[model samples]
Target chain A: MSSPPRDAPGAGVLRAAFAVARKELGESFRDRQTLLYTFVLPLCMYPAMFWIMVQGVLVVQGQKQARDVTVGVVATAETAEAARGQLALDEEGRGRIEVVALDPETPRDADAIAELIEGEEADALLFLPDGRSEDDPAALFFDSTSSQSETARGRVVSALEGWTEELRAEAAEARELDPEVLEPILIQTRKINPSKDDGALVLSLLLPILLVVMCVLGAFFPAVDLTAGEKERQTAETTLLLPIPRLGLHLGKIFAVCATSMIAATLNLLALGLSAGHLLGQLAGLGDGAPKVELPLGALISIAPLAALFAFFVSAVLTGVASLAASFKEGQALLGPVQMLFMLPAMATNLPGMELTATTAWIPVVNVSLAFRGLLVGSASAGPLLLCAFSLTVAALFAIWFSVRLLSSEEVSLSSETISMTRILRILRPR
Target chain B: MTDPTNTSAIRAEGLAKTFHDPQRGVVEAVKGVDLDCRKGEIFGLLGPNGAGKTTTLRMLSTILAPTAGRALIDGVDVAEDPLEVRRRLGFLSGSTGLYPRLTGRETLRYFGRLHGLEGERLEAAIARAFDAFDLHAFGDGRCEALSTGQKQRVSIARAVLHDPPVLILDEPTTGLDIMASSDMIQFIESRREAGTCVLFSTHILSEAERLCDRIGIVYDGRMLAAGSLDELRAMTGKEWLEEIFRELVQRADAGEGAA
Candidate 1:
């Protein structure tokens, strides 16, 4: 690394690097399809898709909340009408329950009730015993797989308890028995720490998943262009002869790939935010009164770094892997499973009650989701945030080093299509 | 640095490059080749494909380090300091690529800047290259849009933009039409007359015969013969270089058969 004389005739390595970099950027931007893939499509697709899904989910939720539920009534004594009246009283107490009468002689089978729950014909089923005594046993059937069914069961039980209390109070007043004898233990609950916002909770989780998809998608095109595209065009051979250092060329291209991915992630984030806000505003307008969900600027700020770092790491690693794959087609084939690997973690982040511990923070795509959740809810610890960032940076550097090493080797740079194991063995042979 | 007025532009001695395949043992690309090229001279390295001509050129340009021996460009050790050697030489080859996305003008300007040319000087160089190469007709055309010969001309322009004392061309006219080839041959002779030391490799005997002051016949990574065209003719006792080459290769093949 000694200093060389100025005014020398040959070009400097920095100049060669810039020449190559400028050319790559210009070519990439000039292609109409590339521009769309890099910027326009990401901006359009993310929000449009997310908005549709969210709105669909909210509609289903609204319907569930409003749906009326059915309960069963069984005659136990000679006063079948009186028993029906008691069931009516139960329904009235629950306020939203609709009671369906059943024959007492039918034995009120639990299997029939379970079938009703499974078929979705009933949100829940009730089995009443053939007795008027307050001590008579009763049963409720619910589908554990259905949250709505479970909730309906809970509502029915609470209404029955309310009816029993009213009846006992009336009997005590009439017979002059002590009202305190019927009292039992009561439980009450109040949330001490309210979550920041429902939207924040949902969006944060959603954003991480979006980031993982964006990172993987963002790496795709640049990796193709840098490796296979160059090879197909016969540009790689010329590139090898450049006076610039090998590492410089690799880094310059890697930087472009990282930048490409970051642009995509940013566009995706913006599109999602705008579309989500529009959907929320519409829902609130519908009288459901869902609160306006603004992307909190602080949360947005926190997400920016996480998204950028994740994208950089993904692009770097993918570019390295792409370089080794021999061709664009092979690279795509190789990355198909890799894409699945990345997407699964993102999908796992959306599973209800999934918690993020330190271990989760180190696993590539999953960690980004966990960090997003923490940042959005205003509970993100700085330690974990920094740790995830450091891990991503290290991964990116590793990828860059691997790619550089590949680019530096004569065997890799000079590789042709239809490579044979013998030829590879020949290259690997010691001189 | 050597005395600029007295020293040859390039001096290479006993250059060798060996490729060792894990399964095949060793394949030598170049073997013990020595060369001296003075200013205002065109030295040709004539050989078949895979005969180590490109490898020798790569070593001399500092793109490949010699497995054995050393080289000096104007007295700076190329193996020790390639960056220094790079600044002293201009290189072009059939495989040298043009950035297809960039216009010819932009390509030249970009490369000029890389060589630390800027402001008026850079502009002047770009303008001179365009005019001298007749690149003005399509200077604004993107490289991908240019015809193959046009791209070749642009590649040559990029190489000489900095006007180094030494020029290296590896099959620079392999795919060009006759007109383009003649233009290129003239350009190389002019560059030499302007005091640039030139070394070109080609499989075409006619090109080397017409343009080179001294020609080195390389085969199987070894220099089979080296001398001026007349000296080579006298030594081989053949009037035509093609006849001499055929005879020599036939002899080599016969020797191998006997072995």
Candidate 2:
């Protein structure tokens, strides 16, 4: 066969890099451990964990609501009558609360109230002083430590608030005034962007941080395998002897790692976003008015480039750091702290008022987080987003440069010495 | 300095390397080594452990840069143009490992692409390699599942996938069984007949004696002597290559003490 056509000088390196990436990715897909971390776990873990949590909460709440409680009334005949009328309208309904009519001459004291609860005569005691009027404050005494007492107190409070509102409206009617006069200042809320989905707002708050973390996690194992794993398996020297520049090999590993990380992040978001509506609806006990949790396709498309850039940055940094270690276990130990550097900046999205700004767009992981959040919420400006993309591109390039330089050094790449900070510093020092 | 016009496929002069150890300060791994091998020549570097044979070969392969002097591969300066030098050379060591997840054929394809071979040309080269090495039976199986001899054959196939003119093997038969070792020796001899220059380091004296056209004995990071077997035997007044090696080492040690 005749020789293959030659590529232009620059394209040759790129082609070699792509070849390396293809091999790494193909190998990773075959490894059970890498597949578990990159694809299988993300696809299953989020949905399973959310389901267990939501079911647990619903079970506990159902059990709490199923229990019954009794309350004793100690007051004058007039007040007792009024109290019984209001207590019958308990928000939990009459069957949940059994009203025990105590003697009208019963003492209104702490000892009596405590005995009512502690002796099981009632779960709580409602005490209204003699000659108490509608304006006079009444006391419901219950044990805060007892679940039954707390449940009873909750029901009684709801019933009494309803009774008080009725009394206030009656007083207003007697004075020949509108009941609206009772509440002078009523505040109303409206969304500034009415078209923005409420579910998208919730997802924006959550998905950005999750995406950042998943990206880091997705890059974690592959980076270790491609770099330190090569040394441990004794393939580093053979790979280095290939007729391509070290930069091509470094970029190839980074591309493979970036692809895995982006896939993981995307899969995790899909699982969570799809299940969120059902999980939240169960939590809120809203059957029909549950907000539909959907990832807006436009927002997702807009944020994808930033996410990919961020994944590249993360993959490059991790692969570079992992190359300093001589084995996989040591690579993991060294990278534990480095992973935190990306995590802390990603949590910038959790800050109450944090958003993409000119200054924030220049920050590395922080910019990615804020940009994702803003894009999801339909609040992102193109200027800051462009700046964020530029910043991430620079960071990714620098990471590639650093990794190429590190992998090129014979002391770091070829030596079997144990990794240490001093040694890494020495290797990084200008020759 | 290297002579661009020389037909030597492998050449080195006064190659040296030093490393820094936190406890030992500056450690000279390879003090100074000189070598020359022509096309179709089989040169063996015979040394004991820590004798700097591996380090010297590493420098010559362009895997590690020499702290002093220079080397050339097929007339290309190793340090000045390592990519071109690598393209012209094939390097293998006992420590060189294969990707366990890849099949034998995939591993060949990967290296072929790195050498700028693609499409039908790459496939044809891979097929020829498989046929030549008798690797068809297990070529589609993962390398991790292959036996020691089989992995060695695949590794050799990978090293020569691009048919480099110069070959470097460092203790290539170190972990092989007797049968595997014999197969490796036969492969090295075959390369000689193909007009490929072969440079290898080994501590096994008999293997070197059987295969090398010229042998260099290195001791404590220095080349004590280099010559054909008969020339060494005559120089040391010894019959066996082992006795000649011992005589040269003793002479070097006695020379060091007198200094």
Candidate 3:
């Protein structure tokens, strides 16, 4: 009898690895928990969260606008008329201010003003001496403890400032001078990259942290399931008995985990991208003038390689760390702290002046975050970006190597040995 | 080097394993033990719990490496070329679990692919496994939804999917009902008839007596005596296998006490 044809050595190993990955992905898709975490949550969570936030802000703003306040104007009859006109209502007519004339004999003192405020006769008191010069500042008093008083104080101060500006302009016109000459320094801001999308800026600031978190989360469950879950289910021995190399099996699991992480990140980015413009508009009160939140497809495409490498690195690290555990719950306990390690570094991008640089490009999660931000904002340089990618590649390769070694150990694969720092250190050390 | 002419499908020489625990210091789980099983033979490993039967079988199946001596699966050195040895051997334990999310058919296909079977050949093997295990009734259902007996059948199908020459089953009938246990025994007998070398461990003396062509009794990680039922009875001058086992264990204990 003739024997079947055999694949070349490398081809056979690769085929087995691919088969393992395919099986894992199939199982993951079938698992309801994995599906919920990987796809549905990311798709719905950002939009729902943003919607709730936008609605909350709008509700609070509406409530604040609908409130009205009374202000006592302790001013001369002539100035009182001007104050009435100035403080009648806010520009949108949403904030109404009732201007009441105080008794002419009323004392112009803090105690008297406090008495009027406390008596509920007025929410705020504005005192303007009859004979005060134009240069004399107006005294406005209101109780900070009361929201009405705070609102009245804001209206009166705003009206008085407008009144002062008008008075200054009149004074300047009477002196035969142009009001514009009063301000010599007019700061006009300009952007070097005017084409930089507002959406991209928001994404740059926001996506990095979200990407790191989502990527970690995406890899988290699968890594635990494939390793510790397998052990707990007593399937680890079955997998270990396969004729393939341990490295192949490890690689297959990592590939499946990386795919899930990337899918989650992409879905999160898509959800955030779709909703960020409208959400930011509502939150910033820009309304109709909100900048269109266009995803920087170019930057996204460019950063794909880095994102993939980061996912691979995270998957490998999670897989190896989780494998130390003998049960699914134990894996979660071990990985929960490890997640903070990735998250805190990604958050470093939110710090002001934090950017991708020679030093930062070597840092793991921070480098990827800053790089993603820079790429989106059109600020990334090729040299540092390349360095960052190289560093991640090396780290990812190292993580894969370490994970394969860990999986290859019989004690780890077969025994429910108590995890220890010494054992971990031993694994980390070269054999 | 292994002799190609040797009929032994499973062979071990002084196979041993030791574990290092932080609190317990050094502990030897399997002291030097030796065994041989020829093709078309059923060798039963009889031992009490914690007697190192599982550990020994693990070494021969290439799941755990032997810390001392050597093991060979179908003439392939276990430690030297574990992957090749694995290809020649099918290993199953009571605890060998199936993927809960995968259907039985999918699980078979996965194992088949891992064993380098694919395309038409893979499908053919999977079909045959499904038929052989009477799994068609529930093959499409997720393993998590299957009954215990059904899952065991699927696990057995998975082990034998690669058509390996040497089969190492560690307490295959453990946790099974009377009917399931009988089915498992019948399957082991079938494998022996098909010229597959079967080495299984069981603490159930009745099972060893009923199914094993040659029984090797193990105690405290040491093999006490190995022979056919008649040879063992004659050696111990006992009529029943249970009495023979007790006599052998008592003698080993006496020897240890004297030492």
| Leading candidate by TM-score | 3
- In candidate 3, what are the lDDT values of residues A170-235, reduced to their tens digit? 878999999878757779987554433766787788988988999999999999899888888888
On residues B160-254, what C-alpha lDDT tens digit does candidate 2 reach at each position?
A: 88888899999999999898888899999999998899999999999899999999999989988888999888778999999989989899888
Q: Order of candidates by DockQ, top first? A: 3, 2, 1
TM-score of chain B of 2: 0.96
Minimum summed lDDT over a 10-residue window in model 3 chain B is located at: B250-259
Expressed as tens digits, the lDDT of each residue in A91-186 for candidate 2 is 442346677878866666778678768989999988777644676446788899998899889888888788879888998999999999999988
Question: Where does the lowest 10-residue lDDT sum fall in candidate 2 chain B?
Answer: B250-259
Name the top DockQ candidate: 3
Q: Candidate 3 has which clashing residue pairs, if any?
A: none
Model 1, chain A: how large is the TM-score? 0.75
- lDDT head-to-head 1 vs 3, winner: 3
lDDT (tens digit, per residue) of candidate 1 on A158-269: 7667667777898788888777666665567854443337667657766777777877777677776777667766677556545556566776677677777777767776
**What's model 2's TM-score?**
0.91
TM-score of chain A of each: 0.75, 0.84, 0.85
Question: Docking quality tier of candidate 1?
Answer: acceptable
| All candidates: TM-score | 0.80, 0.91, 0.92
